[model samples]
Target: MRLIIAGLFALAVMLSPAAYAVQPDEIMADPVKEARARDLSRELRCMVCQNQSIDDSEAPLARDLRLLVRERIAAGDSDSQVIDFLVARYGEFVLLKPRFERQTWLLWLLTPLALAGGGLALWMHGRRRPKSAPGEDGSEAILSAAEEARLQRLMAAEPPPESPS
Candidate 1:
């Protein structure tokens, strides 16, 4: 009985994905167009899925995008031209590998600039931090033996209860 229940559970789980499945409307009129549609759909990101390509996604927008690709292919648009058209309609964010250009130059440069800026900030912070030893201005750390003991005790203090949980 347990084995039968387990088999039924596995089948249910496998078939659960068929609930919001792709429909017939997503197909192209011609098989040749359908092949192109499938290829293009794999390249095109699904706006709704945000990560999965249109071909892998079962979303309505993905289906529409698939149909749009089929229509474009049937109209005899070259692959590059079709991609360019979509890029023009949607921003470079749609393409998995965005074309590097004047418009997207800032996007390409921003991460490196941010990293350099952060490194600069960290360098500046380290420079500005008060030196602990008698190195920066030759002022020796004059923590008395008692004060050092007290500081050590404070540092070794146990953590309090984490009330947020």
Candidate 2:
């Protein structure tokens, strides 16, 4: 049915990868340079949309960044040079994935360090736990003499329940 076809089309659009936000006017005439610009845009963050790559962000700042990338590429700057220029201009926050450096060592190492610390603490906790000896019912808890006597007395004092007539 037409309804089902329309629904399928809608679902396909929704499931597809996000469309790039670059406008027609922003595209460079040279395909090679444009492609390079696009690749660089995808690596740079949209300052306005902090989590989104400039290539995928529709923000005015993202558009400017895309244009800047194209301008840099046209000026014969290499990818790394363009990236370094942007970093110098906007700080490291402009990069979608920051490079590992002495300044960023803590940011890059914190997660693995925390995970290792947690694993070590869990291992120590497991080792420190007293192990129960296996018995007929799986684990035997050894009761003290007074506790055993108390249990015996309590069991002996409990009356047997009468069976239902």
Candidate 3:
């Protein structure tokens, strides 16, 4: 059926690896430099697209970033130097994976800290909960001895039910 074929095509597109955005004109004559450029491009974020790397985005800003990386490579800048230049220009946000330093310590540790807090809360909640009696199916009201006595008194005050002959 047409629907089945369309679904299969959609699935194939989704399962495919990320597409490369580097055009033919952007490739360098030297394979080594080109490889380095590609590696750096993969590490750089596409400012316009926000989610994809420069190497995998089709946005104009991503294209510019790709070209800039190639230019730095051609100019004999070391990988570290190129990365430093980008960091200086775009701040640390340009890096896909930020360094674990004092400035970013909260970002790195927030999840674990929250998870530990949640676990402690759950444990404390369980500890403080009232224990249900055996065979109590959780639907009946749980009452203390004094409250049960009061309920019995109230029931005795009511008239007895009349039975049909």
- C-alpha RMSD between model 1 and the true structure: 10.9
In model 3, pairs of residues that clash are none
Q: Count the backbone clashes (under 3 Å) in each candidate.
A: 0, 0, 0
TM-score of each: 0.52, 0.75, 0.68
Which ranges of candidate 1 are over 4 A from the true structure? 1-36, 49-51, 90-93, 130-165
Cα lDDT computed for each candidate against the true fold: 0.76, 0.90, 0.89
In terms of lDDT, the poorest run of 10 residues in model 1 is: 14-23
Q: Mind sharing the TM-score for model 2?
A: 0.75
Candidate 2: how many backbone clashes?
0
> What are the runs in model 3 whose C-alpha is more than 4 Å off?
1-20, 134-165
RMSD of each: 10.9, 4.8, 6.4
Model 1 lDDT tens row, 1-165: 999999999889667633333456767668877777677766788788788777777788877776777778888998887788888888676676667899888888999999999999999999999767654467666788999999889878967667885
